[model samples]
Target chain A: MTAESNITWKANFPDSFLWAEWEDEEASVFFHRGSGETLLLNPLGAYLLKTICSEDISEEKLAQRTVRYFDLPVDEELLSAISVSLHTFEQKGLLLSSASQ
Target chain B: MKPLDLKPGEIARLLRSNGLRLQIGPFAVSLRSRLRRVAEQIAFFYGDYPRIEADAFVDFHIQINNPAGLRHWVRPQAIFSFDGFKPFKPLPEDQAFAMFEWGLNWCIATTSHQFLITHAAVVAKNGQAIIFPGEPGAGKSTLCAALVSRGWQLLSDEMALIDPGDLSITPVPRPIGLKNESIAIMKNYGDETLVGPPVTDTIKGTVAHMRPPADSIVHADRDTRPGYIIFPTYSAAADSQLDKVEKTRALVRIAEQSFNYHILGREGFRTVERLVSRCPAFDLRYSQLDSAIAEIDALL
Candidate 1:
């Protein structure tokens, strides 16, 4: 595990996020009022942001939650994908992270 | 009273004097032009539109006239001014009428903040509207014209003014602007007499305006709820196809096509969300107008 993986992250503007999802589709659209950015998210990206919006979580925990949520087997590939998504969300200013104590 | 009620000399006199005030959709526009072609085309294309009284409030005061000094005689240029400020550079005098149509589009897109505006063509049937949002040369105007010729009501051929409050599309029926071969295609498909003379050598290249159906202008006050959002692409090699589009993808595509999406901010996002949520979207690719029209007719 890398040091970046230990950081805890939460949605940057939890209250400012407006989301719309359809029952039959895996993709969803969200608008971030703070940044005034609208984004379309695939199923995994949508699930990750939604999970993080509820509470702060470490990358390891997030990967585990994602695995359990999607009913996928535990694997390093899943963990690496989750790490990349976390950093991508951080780069987009959609997620904020802090050092875990 | 409609513009058709006035004689040719009277239309010219009104335009040269205090300006011809006409109620276009929801706004009252006062147009003053010394150019004879502008006055004539206004009467030809907008004959069914209601004329506002001289004393009534006017939303836009527009003037199209020759530029001052030697440029007016040398190159023969026409300048478009909103109020007193000229917003665009002068074009050739032959393009004076096209300039008026484009200038009015600019005036409405910039000033109308109450509605979420998209650079799309809107057409209606059975109280439901289908919005075709695409960039220029995407054949939106061609498709819109073809549909209107087949008994569909033409809401607008340029922009879709969507009410944010209820997501209803406000009708702003205007002459359909056709370019290149689309102009010739529509001429043969519909009433050739309804089309204005083709003006060539402008920025858009060989453009003409098709008068909206008389019934469309008469029913301009009626707004329709959004029924479908379709992105159309005209390809000579492709067969007519209307494929389903996911709602989230549709929302993003529509936001990209909107003229005032960023201006309306959160309200714009919410309004578009409501629109996509309610209306099913499709990606339509077709070369044949009849087949395309048939596919669309099957939608509603």
Candidate 2:
């Protein structure tokens, strides 16, 4: 997908998902449950999912925010990863696309 | 009045005729068994358990005896009945007492929903409770037996009953099931008076039950908030070690090991989340009983 394509992907998370989390120096664990599925997420994945649930944000904005806040390398690969993660979340019914909502 | 207050002959007569009503933990149990060995064991082992009044509400009506058949003479077998329905196939006649214990556990696990029950051994010290959740061979019962003898109160040796209303653990103190080498270990490590006769060959190898301390039964209704969630692993080559378990991991493990977690669904998830958040979790491994006790004592 083009860099501009990432800017159109606004998503939301359902309220029915129950969650519990724990974090250490290396990674954070997220136990997310809803619709008969329980998913375990790493720190980056958990952050991305929680961000979507907490706000109505696009994939490009989330990636930019993540890179700025966590001081990660900003590159094409990182942007592609963010787009793929948001899509994965939508496929799992964890993220509700603005069009779908 | 305690069961001991009744003469053994009277207890036997009631078992053979009407039934003996017992106040075990929060449940009213009516047990009827004609086997003489059951009566003798009840007199010796259950003497400390107080008798529930005849008019009280009975939660489970149980009976253990040899069924009428030609096999009654050829190869006698004892059947355990709950509410007039037999849930299990008849075991050897000699396993009547053990059957009673197993059946009682089945009754509670299947019926109780007000409390979140887990397959764990719970013991308390200094007003704090430690819940030991483990599989069948995890040495939980052996650890429970040893802890209760060293001045800790035995809440229960098989089940940890957590009242959902307040999240406090209610004591259901009963006998600690010791199996195989652990039975011998408990006898050698602690006072012999704490244990009962070994019942062999029924299911989980050679099994013996250790009677709970009298003080534990006397304070059966008192509830304590959980302070620690410990998963014990017994290994002969391992040195005593207590490793910290992360909260999320601890919650998942407890839910996986619970008797009614799935049945309770979202409520079960919330209860375990609250419990794990409030209590520190650990994995303890030990080979020696004394050292294991010492490490746990240090926790309090």
Best by TM-score: 1
**Residues B21-44 of candidate 2: C-alpha lDDT, one tens digit per residue:** 989888889999999988987877
lDDT of each: 0.90, 0.83
How much is the lDDT of residue B143 in candidate 1?
96
**Model 1 segments more than 4 A misplaced:** A1-3, A73-77, A98-101, B1-4
B23 Cα displacement, candidate 1 (Å): 0.6
Of the native A-B interface contacts, what share survives in model 1? 0.84
Give the poorly placed runs of model 2, Cα more than 4 Å off.
Answer: A1-13, A22-40, A44-101, B1-4
Q: Specify the highest-DockQ model's number.
A: 1
> lDDT for model 2, on a 0 to 1 scale?
0.83
Write one digit per residue (lDDT tens) for candidate 1, span A2-90: 32455889999799888988898888898888777889988788899999999998877887778889999877777777878877878
The 10-residue segment of model 2 chain B with minimum total lDDT is B1-10
User: Candidate 2 clash total?
Assistant: 0
State every prediction's TM-score relative to the real structure.
0.93, 0.84
Chain A TM per prediction: 0.87, 0.74
